[model samples]
Target chain A: AQSVTQLDSQVPVFEEAPVELRCNYSSSVSVYLFWYVQYPNQGLQLLLKYLSGSTLVKGINGFEAEFNKSQTSFHLRKPSVHISDTAEYFCAVIPVYNTDKLIFGTGTRLQVFP
Target chain B: DTAVSQTPKYLVTQMGNDKSIKCEQNLGHDTMYWYKQDSKKFLKIMFSYNNKELIINETVPNRFSPKSPDKAHLNLHINSLELGDSAVYFCASSQVVTGDNYGYTFGSGTRLTVV
Candidate 1:
């Protein structure tokens, strides 16, 4: 089985400031990493993913994440956050083989203030 | 057009009542999934279907049943709803591709509140 842990429960940052959301995963085998964002009363939307290529993966809304194999971490980062970026973020992982079901973290709320 | 759509975005019902949440995906994906998000904002996969075949069924209670009539539709039917079952249920679908990567497209989610 695969599991994910989001270190931070909430991260507050001023608008235009950089932000980082930490995520860690534990799996018996190799896995795929993903980040998702959800606004209030909305379902999760895919942000970025790290599969096999470069360690640095970029996604929509100017968000990016780095996959670190040794540390079993995939942290999401944004150079400058906008007020609209405030949302709940989730880090997920799926085993290399087996089913495509994703194991999500507890989620971290990113609050971008003006 | 919405990639993944769910009907009755909000469902409020009483205990012991049965309700069904409908989900549809038009992305031509071969896999569909049902997930539950608790009040604490923890997302967990409940069931997954591929090509209308049940593939992954989590340790969800028997009262929670998932039915996939076709490749594009997956519905969740809950019997004897309980207070703990009240949460946001999301429907997602993904296409099986290489790179060990598959992007999931999620529905707007149905918020179920059992009184």
Candidate 2:
């Protein structure tokens, strides 16, 4: 069984400032990591993913995440955030050799203040 | 164009009533899934179908039933609606079974309210 943990439930950051959302996972085998963004009253949209090769993965809207195997961490980061960036972000994981099911974290609410 | 689409964007029904939410994917993916997001915004997988075959069935109650007429369409029917069933239901599709680059494309989501 695999489980995902998102430490922060809510993160408040100012516009044009940097932000980071912490995510960690626990799995016996290799797993795929993903970040999804959910706007108000909408479904989730894939932000980025860490499959293999390169620890640093870049995604849409200038979002990026670094995968650290030792720490079992895949932290999402953005150099500069905008008001439109405010949304609920979810961190999910899928075991490589197991079922197609995805294990998701509780979610982190990002509030980008002006 | 919407890759995955779900009908009845918002549904408000009385308790003990029965309802169904339809989902269709235009991405031509082999697998489709239904997930429920509660008031706390926690997303949990309810069921998964691959090529019209039931593959994954989580701990969801027996009141929830998922039907797949074909690979492109998966519909969810609730037998007896309850207040706990009120949440945002999303339909998603994916190509890869597991591992990296295997990400899902989600629908707009259907908000179900049981009054």
Candidate 3:
């Protein structure tokens, strides 16, 4: 079985400050990783995905993540964040065997203050 | 147009009552799924349908049934709802290609409250 763990339950940062949301996954074989963001009372939106190729992948809203196979982690980072960036971020994984089942981790609440 | 949409954005009902939540996807995706988000915002997949055929059914209670009339729609019917059933349910769709599948497009979600 595959699972995702997000160490931080909540992260507080001031506007224009940098932030990193850590995510770790457990899988024996290769897996696909994804990051999703959900605003208040809204569905989740895909932030970025790591399927193949380079270790670092970039996505919308100026967010990027690096897939570290040795550490079995995919951490999301932003050089600077805005007030509108406040939302719940989730890290999900799909084991190569069962691509249909997406296992999501407990979300991390990103609270941006002014 | 919304890629995925779920009806009854909010549903509040009493325990032991039965209710259904409907989902439709405008995207021509062949697969649809239902996910439950608990009060703590943890998400878990409940059911999945591909081309109106049941494919993946997690270890969910039998009281929670899913129906897919067509490839574009998947509905969930809950029986004898309990307070634990009170959570946000999300509908999502995706197109599966040969080897790898794309990411899912999620609906706004239905907030079900059982009192």
Which is the leading candidate under DockQ? 1
lDDT of 3 by residue, A1-114 (tens): 899999999999999999999999999878989999999999999999988889999999999999999999999999999999999999999876666888999999999999
lDDT digits (tens) for residues B1-115 of candidate 1: 9999998899999999999999999999999999999899989899999999999899999999999999999999999999999999999999886555577889999999999
Query: What is the TM-score of each candidate's chain B when compared with the real chain B?
Result: 0.96, 0.95, 0.95
True contacts kept of each: 0.77, 0.69, 0.71
Give the per-residue lDDT digits (tens) of candidate 2, residues A1-114. Answer: 899999999999999999999999999899989999999888899999888899999999999999999999999999999999999999999887754688899999999999
Task: Name the candidate that leads on TM-score.
Answer: 2
Which candidate number maximizes lDDT? Answer: 3
Model 1 clashing residue pairs (backbone):
none
In terms of TM-score, which candidate is stronger, 2 or 3? 2
**Range of the 10 consecutive residues with the lowest summed lDDT in candidate 3 chain A:** A94-103
Model 2 agreement with the true structure over B1-115: per-residue lDDT tens digits: 8899999999999999999999999988999999999999999999999999999999999999999999999999998899999999999988866445478899999999999
Error of 2 at A16 (Å): 0.9
lDDT, candidate 2, at B42? 98
Order the numbered candidates by lDDT, best leading: 3, 2, 1
Question: What value does the lDDT take at residue A28 in candidate 3?
Answer: 88
Give lDDT per model, in order. 0.93, 0.94, 0.94
lDDT per residue as tens, model 3, B1-115: 9889999999999999999999999999999999999999999999999999999999999999999999999999999999999999999998874443478889999999999
DockQ of each: 0.72, 0.70, 0.70
TM-score of 2: 0.97
